[model samples]
Target: MGVKAWLSKPLAAYVHKKQQHWIQHPVEAQKAIFDKIIRKAAGTKFGREHHFDKIKTHADFVKAVPVRDYEGLASYFELVQQGVKDVLWPGKPIYLAKTSGTTSGAKYIPITKDSIPNHINGAKNALLAYIHETGNAGFLDGKLIFLSGSPELEEVGGIPTGRLSGIVNHHVPGYLRTNQMPSYETNCIEDWEVKLDQIIEETIDENMTLISGIPPWVQMYFDKLIRQTGKPIKDIFPNYSLFVYGGVNFEPYRKRLRESMGRCIPSIETFPASEGFFAYQNEQQDKSLLLLLDTGIFYEFIPVDEYFNENPTRLTIGEVQIGVNYALIISSNAGLWAYSIGDTIRFTSIKPYKILVSGRIKHFISAFGEHVIGEEVEQAMDRTMAKYQSAELIEFTVAPYVSQDQGQSYHEWLVEFSRPPHDLGDFEKDLNMQMQQINTYYNDLITGNVLQNLKISVLPMGTFRSYMKSQGKLGGQNKVPRLSNDRQLADGLLAITSS
Candidate 1:
C-alpha cells in the first residue's frame, strides 16, 4: 500500500477511538473542546471582539449568537466569491460544497480540514449502525455504488467550486475508493443528461452491494433501468444489499422503493448538508440519533410555532426537550457562530437525543393565509397512505395556488405513486379528509372561510423525474422540494402538474 493508504486505517482507528471515548464521557468532552475553541477564537481579533464577546457560557453561546438563515451568510459568501481568506474561518478552506439555496440562487459553503472529520465520523456511525442492526459487517465489503454529483470543480468567478457530494468523494479512503464505480472528480460529468445516461449504463451489469444517493435520482435511474431492460430492478442486479441516502426524508419514498426493489434493502438515512453532516440513524432506526460531533460544531435548537416564526427560547443538546420541533442552530469549527440552516426538526427522545426532521422553516405555506407545517402534512399523508392498502408514494410536492379573482386560497398537491391506488378519487378524498382530521386548525381555516379550497393531483408516471431533469436538478444531492412557497416557482411547477 502507498504511504497515505497505509496511514489511513490507523488514523481512522485513532479517531474512532477518540469518538467512542467522547461519546461515553460527554461532560468532559464538551468542556475540553469548548475551552479549546474559545481559546482559539479569543486569541484572534475578530473572534475576541465579535465571537467571544457574545459567548459567556455554553448557554450564552446558544443565545447571543442570533439564529441566522442563508441570507445571513451573505457576507461570508461574498468573501469566498472574492477569494478572500478568513472571512468566516481562521484560514483558507480545503474545499467548498456548492448547493442551491431556496431563495439565494446558489450557495458556496467552505469546508476546512477540521470540519471534514465531522462528515467522516457521521458516515462511520451510519456504517456502525448498519453492522449492529444487520449483524453483517461483510455486507459492505463489495463494490459500492454512489450516485453522486460530478466531481468537476467549476470555477465560480475564478474560484474552485464543486457539489458537497464531490468534496466528500475526494476524501473517501483509498481501499474503498478503488472499488467505487465512478472515481472521484472523473465520474461527475458536467452535462446532466449525459451523466444520468452514463450512470444508468454503468449500474446495469454491476453487482452493486450498496447504493447511496438522494431518493428522487435513485427512482429516476431505476425508472430508466426498468424501461430500458424490460425487467424489474431485482432481476437487473439482485446482489444489492443496502440503500444509503440523505438530503431529504425517505418516508414518502420508502413504499414505492420497496415495491421496485421487490423486497426490503436495509436502508440508512443520513442527515447531511453543505454545512456539515449533523446526524445519522442509529441501530434502532426509530429516528435519526444526533451523534454530537463536539470537535466540529456546537449545536443549538430554537422552537418555531405553527405559523413558522422562530420562538425566543433556544436549547442546546443538553437542554433539548422531547417531542418538540425546533429549528437547528449551529456554530461550527468553520466559524459559523449561531447560524440557522432553516431546517426544522423534532426530538423523538432526549436521553440519547433522537430527532425527526420536521421540514424547512422557509418551505411552508403561509401566504395562503393558513399555517401548514411539515409535520401536519406528513401525518395527513401517512394516514392517507394507510387507508389505501399500503400504496407507497414515490415523490411529492405541495404548494398553495390562489385564484385570479378575490376568493379563498387552496392547496394543490402533485404526487407520484409507485403502485396505483385501487380508486384514485377515493385516495384523493381520503387524503383531504385526513388533512382536515389531523389539523383541526387547518380544518377550521378551510371551513370557516379562511381558505377557499384543497386539491390533490396525481401526476403521470415518470413526470417527477422529467420535471426534475428539465430543471437541471436530477441527481444525488437535489430533492423534490416538499413545499414550494415562492409563487413564481410554484406556478412554474404547477404548469407541468401533468393532466
Candidate 2:
C-alpha cells in the first residue's frame, strides 16, 4: 500500500470504531450526532441563506425547508456542472459523479473531499458488517470485477462531468486500482458495442473472486462472458463467492445470477449514490439495512403519506417504525439540506434500522389518473410468479402507455424470463389478473372504470437490456429503471416496440 493508503487505514479504523459505537447505542445518541451535523451544516453559506438556522427542532426543519427533488437543484447544478470552485462546497470539488435524474436530464453531482469520507466510511462499514455476519473477509481477496458505468468524464461547458461511477473510479485506492478491470477514466459511452469485449479482454484470465454492479449489467456481462469462455462463469472463476449490487431491485435479477454463478454465490446490496454512500447490506446479509453514518450526514425520514397529506410528519432515526415506507431526507456536509433523493424505502426493523428500498417516489405509473406505486407492481409481480410456478424472471420494467385510436390506456410489462413458460397465454392472463386484484385503481383503469382506454402487452425477452444500453445506461450500478413515468418512457417504448 502507498503511504497515503497506509495512513488512511488507521483513520478508517478510527471511523469504523465510531460507527460501530453509534450502531449499538440508543436512538438518543444517534440523534445527538445528527443534531450536531445539522447545526454544522446550517453554519454553511447555503444552509445559512436557505434558512437552516431558523429551524430548531427536527420537525421545524422539515416544515421550514420543503423536501427538494433533483429539479430543485437544477439552477445551482449548472454551477457545479461547470466545475466552478466554491459553488456547491467550500473548495474545488474533488470530482463530479454523473448520474441520470428523473426529470432534470443528466446530472453532475459534486463530490468534495469532505463528502468522500462518508462514501468511504459507508463502504467500509458495509464490508465490516458483512464480515461480522458471514465470518469471512477473505471472500473478496480474489479479483473483484465492478460492472460500473463508463469511467469517461464528459466535459459539460468545459468542466468535467460524469456519473458517480466515473468520479469514484478516479479515486480508487491504488492497491485496488490495479485490480479494476477497465480503468475508470475510459470513455464507456463512446465504445458501446465493444465495452463488454474490452472488459473481458482485461480480466477474463484473472482469478476473479467478487462481482459487483446493477443486476442487469452484471447479467449482460456474464452472458457475454459465458459466450466467450464457452463455460459458465462459475467454471471460469471458481473462487468467486460474493455478488455485490445496488441501484435496483435484485429479486428479478437474482435467479439468473445464481444460475450463472451456481447457487453457492452470495449476494449483498449497497445503497451508494453520487450524493453520498448512505447505507448498505447488514453484515448478516439477511436484507439491506440502514447503518447510520453519524459523522458524515444528519438524516430525517418523512413519512411516505406526507407526499399527499399537507400535514407531513417527519421522524428522526429514533422515531422510525418497522414495515412503514418513508421518503429519505438527508442533510449532508455536501451542501444538500433536507434533500429528498426521490427514492422510497421501508423499514424492516428499528433496533438496527434495517430497510428495503420500496422504489423511486417519482417512478410511479399515474398516466390513467391512478397512482400505481412500484411496491404495488413488485408485489403483484411476485404474486403472479408464485401462482404460475414459473421460473424467476431475470428483470422486468413497466410503463403506462395509451392506445391512439381507441384512446385507451393500459400497463405494458417488459419481462425477461429465465425460462419461458409452456403456456405463454396462461402466464399473461394470470399476471394481468393478479395485478388488477392487487390495486383496485389499476384494475379500474384496465376495466375502463378510471380510464376507458387501458391495455397490457409484453415485450420479447432481452428488450429491457437493449433499451437500457440504447440509452447509454448499461452498467452494474444502473438497472433497467423498473418504473418510467417520464416522456422518455414514450420514446423508449416507440424505439423498442417498433424494433
Candidate 3:
C-alpha cells in the first residue's frame, strides 16, 4: 500500500469513532450545535432582531424566528453585501457561495470560518468512512477526478465569491493535490464542452480510481471517454473503483452508468449544498445517508402537505418520523437562521437518523392537485426503463399540458433517448402504468376524468442538452427539473426540438 492509503487506515478509524458518537447520540449532538451557534450569534443583528439570546428551546425558536427562503433574507444579504458586519452572523463571512436557480436569480450564501470545516470535513469523513468500512484506501493511490465548476473567484461585498464546488476546490487537501486530475488550466475553461474535451485529453490514460460529480455531467464525461478511446470506462481506467455523486437521485441513471463502466462498482451518495453539508452515505451497503447531527448546524422539518399553510408545524430531529415528506430547514454557522433551502426530504430511518432527499419544495407537480414529486417520477422512470433493457435513456422531464379549448389536460413526458426503444407505444404504456402505480393521486386524476392518461413525447437526441446550453445552464450543478407544475420548461424543450 502507498503511504497515503496506509496512513488513511488509522485516520479513518479515528473519524469513524467520532461519527459513532454522534450517531448514537443524535439529539444531544444537535442540541450542542444549536446552543453553540445560538449563543455565538446572539449579538449579531439578526440575533438581536429574532431575540436569539432570549430563546432557550426549539419551541421558543419557532416562535421567535420565522422560516424564509433566499428572497425573504434579501434585505439582510444586501446589508452584508454593503460590507455590514454582524448583520446575519457574528461578523463578516470569509467567503460567499454564489449559486443560481432560485426565482430571484443568483443567491449569495455566506460561508464563515466556523462553517467552512463542515463543508470540507463532511466530504473528507465520507471517504474516510468508506475506508474504515471496506479497507479500500487503495483509491487514494490513483488519480481522482472531480468534474466541477471553474475555481475562478470574483468579489462580492469585498469577499471572494464563486460556485460552492469551486470554493471547495480551493480547499482540497495538500496531500491529495498530487492525485487530483485535469490540471488547473483545463478546469478553468469557460465552456463546459471545451473543458470536457480538455479533461478527456488530460486524463484519458491516467490511473484514475475515483470520479466525483453530479450524475449528468459525469455521464457526459463518460460518453466523451467512450467516443475518444472506443473502450468502456472500466477498460479505459481499470483501476477506477469509487463513484461519488450528489444533486440528483442516482437510480434513473444507474443502468446507463453501469453499462458505460462495464460493471457495477461501489458508490457513495452525499447530501451537500451551498447552505450546509447535511448528510452522507456512511456505509457501503446502506444507500440511505446518515444525517450529520454534530455538524455546525441544526435542522428542522415541516411536513410537505403543511408547508404552504399560514402556520406550519416545525419538528426537531426527535420529532421527525420515517416516510413522511418534510421541507428541510436549517440554522447553520453561516448565519442563516430558520432558513428554508427549498429542498424536501424524508427520513428512512430514525434510529440513527438516515434521510433520502425526496424532492424540492418548489420543484413539484401539483398542477391538477395530483402532487407528484421528483422522487416518484425518477422511480417510475427507473422501473419502466428497467424492463426495456435494450433502450437507453438520456434525459427526461414532466410538465402539465393544459388544453386551451376546454379539452382534457394531462401530464406530458418529454424524454431524450440515445437508443430508442423497439416499440415506443409499449414503452409509453409501461411508463404511464408505472406512474399510476407509484402515485395514487396521478392514478385518480386519470381514472376520475379530471385528466387524460399521461402522454410521452420522444424528444430528438441532444434536444435537452441543446436547450440547457441555450439557457447558459449546460453544466456545473445545473439539472433539468424532473417535475415542473407548468408548461414553461416543456415549451422550451419543444421549441428546441422544432428548431
Candidate 4:
C-alpha cells in the first residue's frame, strides 16, 4: 500500500473504535454533552435570560427554555447581528451561516469556535468510518470533488458570513486538500451553471474518485458531463468509487444516478444542518444513520403527532422509541437553546440510536386530513419507478390540488421525467396504489370518496431546474421540497411550465 493508504488504515481503526464507545454508551455521552454546553453557556446573555444556571436535569432544561423556531429567536439573533458580545454563546460567534428562510427572508445561524468542529469532524469521521468498515482507503489517493457553495465570505457584524457549505469549504483539512478538485477559483463563481462548466473544464480529465454533493446537483453535473463528452461518468472517470450525499432521500435518485454513472457504487447518507451535525451512516447495508450523541449538541425530541400541541411532551434520548417520528430540537455549544430546525426524524435502532430523516416538520400535506410526509411520497415514487425500468425521473413534488368547478380534491404529483413510461395511465395507477399502501390516511381518503386518486402532471425535463434558477435557488444546499401542504408551489410550477 502507498503511504496515504497505509497511514489511513490505522487512523480509521482508531476513529471507528472511538465512534463505537459513544455508540455503546449513548445516554452517558449525551448527558455529558448536555452538562458541558449548558454550563459553558450559562454566562452568556441567552443563558442568563433563560435561567440556564439552575438547569439540573432534562426536565428543568425543558421548563427553562421553550422550543423555538428561527422567528421565535429573532430577538437574540438580531442582537448578535448588531455586534454584541456574549449574546448567545460566550463571546461572539466566529461565523454566521446565512441560509434561505421561507417566511423569514434570510436566517443567520451562528457558528462558534467550539461548534465548528462538530460540522468538520462529523464529515471527516464518516469517511474514516467508511474506510474502517469497507477496508478500502484507495480513494484517498485520487481526486475528490465536493460540489459546494463559494468559499468567499462577506462580513456580518465584523464576523464572516456565508452558506453552511461555503463556511465548511474553508475548513477542509490539510491532508484532504491535496486530493480535492475543482480549483478554488472555479468554486467561487456565483453563477452555478458557469461554475459547473468551469468545474467540468477543470476536472474532466483528472483522476476523479469520489463525488460529493446534494443528489440533484450531482445529477446535473453528470448530465452535463455526458452531454459534453458523449460518455458515461464511469467512462470519463474509471476510478470514481464512492458517492457521498445528503439533503434529500437517495432512493428516488438511485436508479437515475446509477444509469448516469453506468453502474452502482457505494454511497454514504448524512444528516447535517446549519444547526449542527446530527448523524451519519455507519453501516453499508443499512441506509439509516447512526446518531452522534457525543457531538457538541444535545438533542431533544417532540413526537410529530404532538408537535403542534400547546405544550408538547419533550423526550430525551432515553425516552425515545424506534419508528416514532419526532421533531428534532437541539441545544448546542453554538448557543442555540431549545431551537427547532423544522426537521423530523424516526429512530430505526435503539441499541446504537440509528435514525432516518423522515421529513421536514413544515413540509407535509394534510389538505384533507391525510398527512402525507416526504418519506411516504419518496418511498411511493421509488417503488413505482422500480416497477418501470424504462422510466427515469428527474424531480417531482406533491401538493393538494382541488378542482374549483367540481369541488373535488386530490393530491397532484408534478413530475419531471427525463424518460416517461410507455403507459402513463398505468404508471399513474401503480403510483396511486403505492401511496395508498404506504400511508393509510391517504388510502382512507381515497376509499371514503373524500378525495380522488392522485394525478401525475407530466412536466418537461429541466422544469424544476428552471423553476429553481428563476427563484435564485439553483445550486448548493437548495432542494425542491418533496411535499407541500398547499398549492402555492403547484401553481407556481404550472405557471413556469406554461410560460
Candidate 5:
C-alpha cells in the first residue's frame, strides 16, 4: 500500500469524528476552547492584568479585556521581543511570524508552543477533511509543494523569526518530508525570482500531486512552469488533483488560474493570518469555510459599521449572524489578548458556522461617503474580467480621488494587465458598470453627478512588482492592498510606475 493511502484511514476517521462532534455542538465547542485557552495562559502578565483567573464566562472575559488593534497591543509585543517570558502566554514564544505591512510597518507575531499545534494541526485537519469528503488520499503519496518564503530564519531578541510559511516549512512532519519537493537549501533563497527559478527546475519533473500557496504567486509559478515545459500545468502534472490557496480573494484569480491549468482541480481556501489559523473549507462542495472552532483561539466579531465606534457591540461566536460584515477579533494561546487581526469576514452559514472574508479592516475606500469595500471590488473585478474573455487583470489597487480640482470626486484604479483588452476604454467602462452594480453608494454618487466616472490607469507591467520590491514585500504571502483607505498604497505604486 502507498504511504498516503496507509495513513489516510486513521486521519479520515479522526476528521469525521471531529466534524460530527462539532456539528452537534457548534456553540459549545467554541466555549470549551475559550475556557481551555483562558486557563492555559492565566499566569501571564496580560492574563494577570486582565484578570484571566477570574474570567470563567464569556461575559466576564469580555468585561476584563478591552478590544484592541495591533497598535494597542504593541507594548506587550515590544516586551516579548526582548525575550520576556510569561508576558502574554505562559512562557516565551517558540517563533515569531514577521508579517508584511504597508501602513503599520513590519509586524512580528508570536507563535507559542501551546499554539504550534493549532497552526500545524489546523492545516492537517483541513487536508484530512478534504480527503474525508472527496475520498482521495493519493495526494499524500506523491510530493506536495508549498510555495513559501525563505526558510532561513533570523533571530529577534533571541526568538526565531521569519515568514509564517517559512516557519511552517521548518516544521513539516518528518513523515511528509520525503514526499515534499525542493531541497531545504533551495527554500532558503530570499530573492523570489531566484527562488522561483530553482523551484521550477527542481519540481518540473517530480511526481507532484498537490500545490499550495497564495493564488497570485502560485499562478506566476504555474505560468513559468508551463513556459518552461511547453505544456499547461495539468499536462505537466497529470496527477495534480489538489490546489490549495488563500491570502487574497480567490474570485479574481479563479478565472485566470482555471485558464492556466486548462482544467479545474479541487481547491480549498483558508483564513490563515499570523495571529492564528482561523478557518478552512471543511466541506468539498461548498464555498463557505467552516470556522476552526476547536483551535486554540477564541473568536469574536464586531459589526464593521460599529467596529470604529467608541463602544462598539462585540459578539461572541453564538451571537454572530449570517451576512453581516464583521471585523474579526481573536484571543489565542499565542499571547494575543482580544486582538483585532485587521481582517473582515461575513458569516455565510449559521449552522456549523461558515464564513467568507469580506476584506481587510484597514483596506477600504470611503472618501466621499461611498463606503466601497473589498468584497465589492473583488466581485466587480470578477464580473468585468469574465465579460472580456481576452482581458487579464494581473494585479490592482484602488483609491479615492476626493478632488475639488475638476469639481467632482472619483475612485481611481491602477491596474496591471497580463493581456490588455482590445479596447482599454471599453474595459474601463465595463469595470465601472460592474462596480456600480455591486456598490449602491458608489452608484448613487455617479447618478447624482456628485462624482465623475471611475478613472482607471493601465499601469505599465511590473508596477505592483516594483512597489512590492521597494516595500521589501516582493512575495511570500504579501499582496498589494486591494482598496486603500487613503492614497498611500496607490500613490506608492504610481511612483514606482513613474520612476
Candidate 6:
C-alpha cells in the first residue's frame, strides 16, 4: 500500500469507531466534552465570574452564563485585546480570526492554544471520515488546493490576526504541504483578485484531486478558469473528486458547480465557526453533518420558533427532536460561554446528531410583519430560477421599501443573474408566489395590501463580488447577507452597481 493510504487507513478506522461510539452514547460524549471545557477554563475570569466552580450540569451552566451574542461578549474580548491572560481562554489567545459578517466594523474571535488544534484536527478528521466511508484516501496522494485566505498574518495588540482559513493554513500537516497548491509566498499576497490570478497561474498545470473553499468565491474562481481556458472544470482537474465546502449554503451553487464539472463529484459540508470547529460532514448518503460531540464545546439548542421568547426552552442532545429549527448556543474552551453563533440549524437525526444550517438569527426581514429568513429567500430564489432552467441566481439581497414616495411598502429583491430569466416579470411573480406560499404572514400582507407584491431589480453582473471586494471581505470565511433588516446591503449594492 502507498504510504499515504497506509497512514490514513488506521486513522480512518479510528474515526469510524469514535463516530459509532458517539452515536451510541451522545449524551455521555457531550457531557464529557462540556465538563472538560469547563475544567480547562475554570481559572479564567469568565469562568470565575460565572461561578464555574459550582456549575455542574448544562442547566447550571446556562443559569450562570446567560446566552450571548458577539456584542454581549465584547467586553471580555476587549480585555483579551490588551494581552490579558486567562480573560476568556486559558492564556492570551495565540490569534484572532477576524470577521465582518454579522456585526459592523471588525469582530475578532479568539483562537487559543487549545482551540487551534481543534480547528486543524477537525479538518483532518473530516478527511479521515470521508476516506473511511468512501475509500477516497488516494486524493491525499495528489495535489489538494484549499482556496484559503491570505496566509499573511498580522498583529492586533500583540496577538496574531487573520482569516480563519489563513490561520489554519499555518498549521497544515507537513506531509500534505508536499501536495497542497498556491505556494506560501503567493498565499501571503493580500489582494484577493491578484491572489486569484496567481492561484490560477500556479494550479493551471497541477494534478489537482481535491479543493476546498466557500461556494460563491470558488464559483467565481471556476468561472474565471473556464473563461481563460475555454473548457469545463472537469477538463482542468480530471481527477478532482472531492470538493469540501462550508461558510455558505451549497444547494444553489451545487447545480452550477456540477454543470461546470460535467460530472458529479462527492462533496462534504462543514460547520466550522470562528469560535470553534463545531461539525463536519461524516456520512455520504445524508446532506446533514454530524455534530462533533467529543470536541471541547458544549452545545445547547433553543427552538427558533421560540428563540425570541422570554424563556425559551434550552434542550441538550438528550432532549432535542429531529426536524426542528434550533438556534445553536455554544460554550467552548475559547471562553465564549453560551454564545449564539448567529446561524440557525435543524437536526436531521437525533442519534449522534446530524444538522443542516437553516438560517441566521440576525439576518431576517420583518418590515411588514412578514418574517422571512436567509434560508427562505435563498430557497425561494433557487426554486424560482430552477423552474425556468434558463435563469441562474449568482447573488441577491432583499430589503423592505417603506419610503413615502413608494406606495404600499414591499420587498425589493436586488438579484444578479448569470443568465437573465426567460421572462423577468413572470420570474418575479413566481418568486413572490413561492415566498407567499411558504409564509402565510407574507401572503396575508399581500392579500390585505399591507405590503405590495415584491419588486425585482436585475442587478448588473459582478455587483455582489464588487461590493464584497470594496468592503474588503471578498474571500475566505466571508459571505453576503441575503436578507437584511435595513437598507445597508440594498443601498450599498445599488451604489456599487450604479458607480
TM-scores for all candidates?
0.89, 0.86, 0.98, 0.98, 0.96, 0.96
Off by over 4 Å in 6: 403-407
Could you tell me the lDDT of residue 393 within candidate 2?
Answer: 74
In the range 72-97, model 4's lDDT, one tens digit per residue, is 99999999988899988999999999
- For candidate 2, lDDT tens digit of each residue in 314-402? 67787888878788887776766667887888888766677888887778888766677787777777776766565657676677766
lDDT of 1: 0.71
Provide the lDDT at 34 for model 4: 95
lDDT of 1 by residue, 73-191 (tens): 68766776676766666766777778988778888887777888887767766776556555555434556877887777777545567988777777777667755875443376866
For model 5, the local distance difference test gives 0.86
Question: lDDT tens string, model 3, 139-194?
Answer: 99999999889899999889999999989999999999999988988888879999
What tens digits encode model 5's per-residue C-alpha lDDT throughout 29-129?
88888888899888889988888889889889878899997779889989998998899988799999998654578889999988888889878878888
lDDT of each: 0.71, 0.69, 0.91, 0.92, 0.86, 0.85
Distance from true position, residue 46, model 5, in Å?
1.2
Please provide, for model 6 over 370-465, each residue's C-alpha lDDT reduced to its tens digit, 9 standing for 90 to 100.
Answer: 788888888888888789887776878899888664347899999888888888999989999999988899899888878889999889998998
Inter-residue clash pairs, candidate 3: none
User: What is the overall TM-score of model 1 with all chains considered together?
Assistant: 0.89
Candidate 3: list runs displaced more than 4 Å. Answer: 404-407
**Which residues of candidate 4, in runs, are more than 4 Å off?**
404-407
Candidate 1 all-Cα RMSD: 3.8
